[model samples]
Target: MATEAKRQKVDDGSESLQDFLQWCDRVGLVLSSKVYVSKEGTAADYGMLAKDSIEEGEVLFTIPRSALLHQGTTKVSSLLEKEKLSLESSSGWVPLLLALLYEYTPSQSHWKPYLSLWSDFKALDHPMFWSKEERVKLLRGTGIPEAVDTDLSNIQREYKDVVLPFMIRHPDLWNPNTHTLDLYTQLVAFVMAYSFQEPQDEEDDEEDEEDEEEKAPNPPMMVPMADMLNHVSNHNANLEFTPESLKMVCVRHIHKGEEVFNTYGQMANCQLLHMYGFTEPYQSNSNDTADIPVINLYKAATQGVQSDSDRRLIEERWELLCQMTQDKGAFVFSKQGCLTDSELHTALKVFCMSEEEFSEFKDNEGWEDDDDEDDERISQALSSEGLLELKPSWKQLIHEAARLTLRSYGDGEEEEKVVDSDRVLMEDRAAFKGLSCRQRRALQVRFGQKMILNRLMELTKL
Candidate 1:
């Protein structure tokens, strides 16, 4: 009976998908015969698939501008326009959210077929929907918990301060019972996960500089068929915007029966899991990065400095850094697990100088070229590799900082070291399969960070 029920569900889904495609055609959405939508196994429920071999540079589909769903194109646009100030003041996404809320509430909507594609709210995986306990348990050190909390707080505030007031005024158009916070939150998740920001036209850049500056950037739009293609780090297709329509074109050849992948820009694992509720396997996302906070470095520098005078000197040096530039953001490790940040290196150099040397350095306002020999030597030493050749104190500082950062991860348990060997990585990838989806994605995010931290420690020979 269970097997029969599963088959029935699949059949219903297939029919719904067909209806959506027919609706797309009626709305002038042009799809190439060589490409169609199909199941992508576990990577996603449905994705664009190659029905036959597709060549590079081939246009797979084109979506008419009228077919795109946003505040401008929705049937309730004029009604929402009356509340434009209220919507714009609350959030950039509010206009579209209101449109979607009203359109999705009624039994009949112009976007009924397109909206059906996203009917399964239960299937959403964005970390924002996860319980606070689940987020803490699975994603404690992944940086997603803080982001999820911020989004939740914003959603609650907007619903109370903006949405509730708008609904209360339009009692005849919208029922509070139907347009509840739960439904609004679901639509917000859809916007976060599925919407795409329309790129500004190049011609817009030539407009009066003052007028362009006054204009707000384009809001996110729900682009049907385009959003159906699942994302991968190294994807085979990209979306191209034209004056009249949006087109999906193949960037590389796709073989028959292969899934046609599109990229969501070069996002890291943490971002992928936070926004989309999924992540590429470990080591697969090329744009991955990890941040080590500046406070960690400061803590490391002050660890053994017992003199109150020295602590004051350290604080003054930090103030000088702040004066030079306001970028106190975290130092990041690149995809190759290397720290090539010049500001961080400069901070270390400033922090390492003795009191007298620091006074001279500050008097010079950070290294003038008045002494040619001294300037030449300093120039050579400031090269990328030279910057990495740290003093003993700087080396120890980095080592301690990385260790402290790792300790911030779950339960202070040491992360398993990942060797730079395919054999070890394959073993790890195989092991990833036994974990639940949430656990596996969480591990991918945290492990990616741990790998970078471990690599940094190795480079410094700690």
Candidate 2:
């Protein structure tokens, strides 16, 4: 929603727009003339805007099933079906990427005009496209680098085993020079940035129910013009799917010339940057989250040099705590990166349980048939007032663990610098000039996590 310059109008007479409209008409798609694709000032290069005032619930466009580009609708489906290519073992994106690759070739695709309007690969700033050195500098301490590496490995394997073999089998259709690994990476990025996982229809859900196995829903799909809408944390429009078509509808009233924004659900800055190459400031995003790696605490608790008996006791206590919490994996901070009282209570209980108490709970399988005394004690211990009963040593351990996790994000000097800044200036200057977008977004996530950890550590003091 930040605008730094005047909106530039795209030429209505442009050949690509004309061709896209003609193609839509040929495919029985209905686009309202009231909306047009145009510059979105500083938000994005292209976004759809209302040419006239639109009311809530009004349909902006409807894309028929025939116009969707997916495994089932693309022309390559027939060829893949002929080859008996079983996508059962492949990830959801595999078949979709193959379908996209097929459609991208010369003259064989009916969706070329629509595809021509896609954003350039060079312009994309998703972390997957970042240089190795950039990633090290910007995302070294974060989980994003590991995720990026995993994605790259999976795509490489898919290309080597599935896509490359299929291309080799059909050399006449796929020229080697045109189907390079670089193109595959770009297409994967394109799919990640634009694809949507549509919900299945009622009939399909019924069929899945009858089938007993209840397989996952079909792969995500590429919807051409619908992908052009820019995202805002508080969006005014959303996509509605029916058996016959996919419709984009105004979810709220819009004045004339206002950009039609679409919601991408509640995502954190890390997720938004990882997928869409953009980040919203903390003030604008109501659903921001930060992840605290509790696994690090588990490791720290178990791996220290200790007497054999002491180490065994610690491991048993840790295992019992994991069972009690159902190993919730990570301590997730929500609501603008602050944990709720209940969440803090849960963390405190998990971190502070004594070995004898854990053994008693384990013996009872969490109070399944608890005697009155045990039941009374646990009920009091887990109550809101029970937080006051935590031992001083347990509180110190929790405080130390929280501090260690925060320190893992950076060296001592950098952590001190981030903690010293006024929170307002940190948020306002997140996009500091001269920093690459990836670096800025990474900094925002790191800063948010440190702030949340600081608050959690303060609670331990209480």
Candidate 3:
């Protein structure tokens, strides 16, 4: 362990989760690919969630430095170049620093979590740094957007979702780094979440005639500790961070053995489902989209467990929980464990799953999008693009399921395409069912009732 890592450790006796991740090799649930897109229906796209209990303002989890690749894919020669420096820090200085950390570490296998950070940072709107010509020269090897000086003013003007906590105490780190070493100066958690982006108003664009479409600020390129809380729209997980240590300190008190969840879809269900790809567990009908509660997931992690599908889910899910917990949920940590793969995977795998199943009981009456035949509201057998996490086969099923449930976009242009009923049925029958009985049931919580209805509706739409 490096000196920096030691300094960042929160060895408060309150935590049952040890300082380092113990199960990286034995675990496969942590999605290794870090490049996740919020909107494009990626592997992170596990459909409808099973209902999990949570309270308002709970500290879902903490970010660990061990899982996060600090300098993110350091191509040393390219990064030093003036042009490519933009690529190194496009998400701000965070990736660049992580890349530096990656540069120093000798052990490659253990560095998966940190290396994954590079992709996440790049996905954000690249922060403008040097002049176009200078940047172009430096950006020779690694393929990314052509380096161009973005108007710093434009960046600030467009800064809501891309916000991060920063300490005014240090100008050096205002750029970005792997850890919070710079912010540690103040004893107090003086750090404030700041953004290179500025605020925007509805009335500011040119021509005033509604030519510009509304776009959200990109998800923060470098979540650092702030990304720990699983994505949830409600304040249930309520994750917060301090600028002083750049550590994401948990403000909400959590009980021991709870699965930590972050605010995954703090935006909306459609946004959450299509983007991160996991459909939150909720009952939806025309009269009740708002009533659909958005809650963060927290699994109760048992102290001991053996290898089994049930155990895998529990362990994988709770790995995030344990890392985020401090001394049995009593205290929260900041600026440490950024490199822990389990936390990174758990955070990345928000609603992600391979399949979901929904069924309507013989007497069940409630359903969504019943009238719209071409509705994409919920559907099956559809394709998705821009989903970065899951493999093509994994996400193909999600796309199909989503198509079955939702209203199709634009005059039924993107509606689900039909396959021969017999052929599809044969395929389902011929293939081996991968999940165990318990695992299948656990997965059904996301796709159970409404999803099945959507599939039935698709038969008519075609």
Query: What would the TM-scores of all predictions be?
Result: 0.86, 0.82, 0.28
In candidate 3, what are the lDDT values of residues 155-220, reduced to their tens digit?
332222222232123234333343333222110011111111222333454444475665544223
**lDDT at residue 401 of model 2 (Cα atoms):** 63
Clashes of 1: 0
Compose the digit string of candidate 1's lDDT tens values, residues 1-462.
Answer: 000000001224787799898999899999999998776441466777888999999999999999999998988788888778877654588889888888886768989888887675777767887789989987776678998998889898998888889989989877778888888888888887788987766677567465735666789999999988878878899999987999999999999987888888988888888887777767877878777777788788788878898889888987887786476557777545334456566777777888888889899898655544354454444343543676777777777777777667747555433323222533675665566767767777877777777767765653
lDDT of 1 at 404: 75
Q: Any runs in candidate 3 off by more than 4 Å, and if so which?
A: 1-81, 85-235, 247-253, 265-277, 284-462
lDDT of 2 at 314: 67
Q: What is the lDDT of residue 378 in candidate 1?
A: 47
Number of the top lDDT candidate:
1
By TM-score, the better pick of 2 and 3 is: 2
TM-score of 2: 0.82
Q: Enumerate residue pairs that collide in model 1.
A: none
Question: How far off is residue 106 in model 2, in Å?
Answer: 0.9
Any idea what lDDT model 1 has? 0.75
Please list the C-alpha lDDT of all candidates, in the order they appear: 0.75, 0.67, 0.29
Show model 1 residue runs off by greater than 4 Å. 1-12, 40-42, 89-91, 202-216, 319-328, 337-340, 354-393, 414-431
